[model samples]
Target: MLSRSRALPAAVLMAALLGLSGCGDDTDEPTTTASDSAGATDSPTASTSPSETAAPSSARTDFCAQIPKPAIRTALYGAAIYDEAWAPGKDADVRGGVHAEGAEFGCAWTAKDGTTVTAWLFAAPVSADEGATLVKKAGAGCEHKKMRAPGADAAVTVQCISDDDTVTRTQALYGDAWLSCSLQTPGILTRLDRAADWCDAVREAALV
Candidate 1:
């Protein structure tokens, strides 16, 4: 029963164990400074600002409906699937940060082997700067990299490997909404590559 509060710190520790260094950048890709990352962590709940509370009336609220079952199966490498809603009041409690307040929608799929893939969608009135800030915050300490996603103003992929498991998180910002998907697998599994694909699938369905 991994909770959201424990996910980011584990990823940070994994980055240290793997000897990974600071975040990288490319001319054509979005970049963030160590200062930006530090600032994000200093204020984890910044996404809950008053402006965000005034999200557009049409902001999406049914994120689970946007995900395709086949995508989940493929992301898990054909593992048996048990679909579960990860809302605030559900059995699977997702506490901490913006998630603690309540996401527009959240879903989790558990593989037969106990691996889990979770996706959360939060719709808010996000500016470009705010979106970038959120991505950096979510990706702190992991090997964060830029990604291209349909309908996304900004996108990033983060990967971390620990002795017991590997965690991959993909995040994208589409207009006034944000979508994030995290995959946790046993050992140093190469299934990390599939994180982007799963995220793309959801972005295509939910945003485009």
Candidate 2:
């Protein structure tokens, strides 16, 4: 069975493969540059941070401190879904964004049994209806589900699971973009429960 650390990388690759059509591909390998941090693009350079290559715990502290609260919330939802309790060696990653056309990129990490689960979320242009449909489709076999906040005109949630050793994942989609969340033992259903709670919390937090 796959752990949690491997999920994010696999999802990002899949998003790219499925023609995810994001605004930028910052998470790509070092060979590719990142787009504008505020919505621009640059040639991919070697990752300067240790978390990018180090274990998840170290990475999480590095990330949690750097990322904004909103982004943290997103990551938290992902983590919750994946059953990650913030183990000693478990951590997450959140990158500076480029604000793609209608999508953006964000990542999170988790670890279990010496394995890590890294999840990626890709944002895309998905209508409220479309977002609802996608989540519904993506969240098969999960209950306590309901699509709340609609993606302003265009957005949908695209989720995936990646297990590359101790890493395991249950990705979730929002808008046309994607964000992957990694966790340990809890399967897809647990992830769904967490996802639902994530949506509810985010919606409440962003109340008008």
Candidate 3:
């Protein structure tokens, strides 16, 4: 297994993977090196639902190209406010990121509001169970619920409450990839509704 060090700077930490439950703080996600997003235009794209990612190898690679950015935007109801690629810089973190020993690369999109969603692709050896645990730890507070999303091997929802602030994160681990969506608003019910929809749309997009 490769070593995964938590190297995300404070700015990027706000947007860590299942450590997901997306975008913690409100910093603009930095752009990935051109080489990282180079093959983003490849076609006949894996539209039939991507196979579960194999265990990651020690080698580093970028696999985000397999997913289309346009599709991602549509999945966010065309309300996506931010989109960025995850590379080996500030965005890398101990879990659910490029630094996670086997992550190829990842792409994320955030809605105009505080809804942050991320799709992480891993080619390393980490299992879906391990990935879910990382997300669980990241949301260690409000509520924990295990779910069954259409294409996911395993799914979970975490709600964290700090003072009057309540944030919810719903995530699903798909083989070598995991999708997480987060929302926090003054209206708790509103936050949950959008978070659920975001997670569902992304799951459908990935499965299609």
Evaluated against the true structure, the overall lDDT of model 2 is 0.28
lDDT of 1 by residue, 91-189 (tens): 222222222233234556667654556666553455567667666556556666555566678776776555555656666677766666666666655
The weakest ten consecutive residues by lDDT in model 2 span 35-44
RMSD to native, candidate 2: 13.8
lDDT of each: 0.50, 0.28, 0.41
Query: What's the C-alpha lDDT at position 130 in model 3?
Result: 65
Best by TM-score: 1
Q: Per-residue lDDT tens digits of candidate 2, residues 10-67?
A: 2333233223232223232111112111111111112211122322221122232233
- All candidates' TM-scores? 0.65, 0.29, 0.48
- Segments in model 2 whose C-alpha atoms lie over 4 Å from true places: 1-104, 112-121, 140-208
Stronger candidate by TM-score (1 vs 3): 1
> Which candidate do you rate higher for TM-score, 1 or 2?
1
Error of 2 at 11 (Å): 11
* Of 1 and 3, the candidate ranking higher by lDDT: 1
Residue-level lDDT of model 3, residues 1-208, one tens digit each, is 1122222232233234223232222222222211111111110112222233454332123443444555545544566554555543333442234442222344555556544445443333445556545454444334775544666666667664433334455655565454444444332433355556655655554442
User: How do these models rank on lDDT, best leading?
Assistant: 1, 3, 2
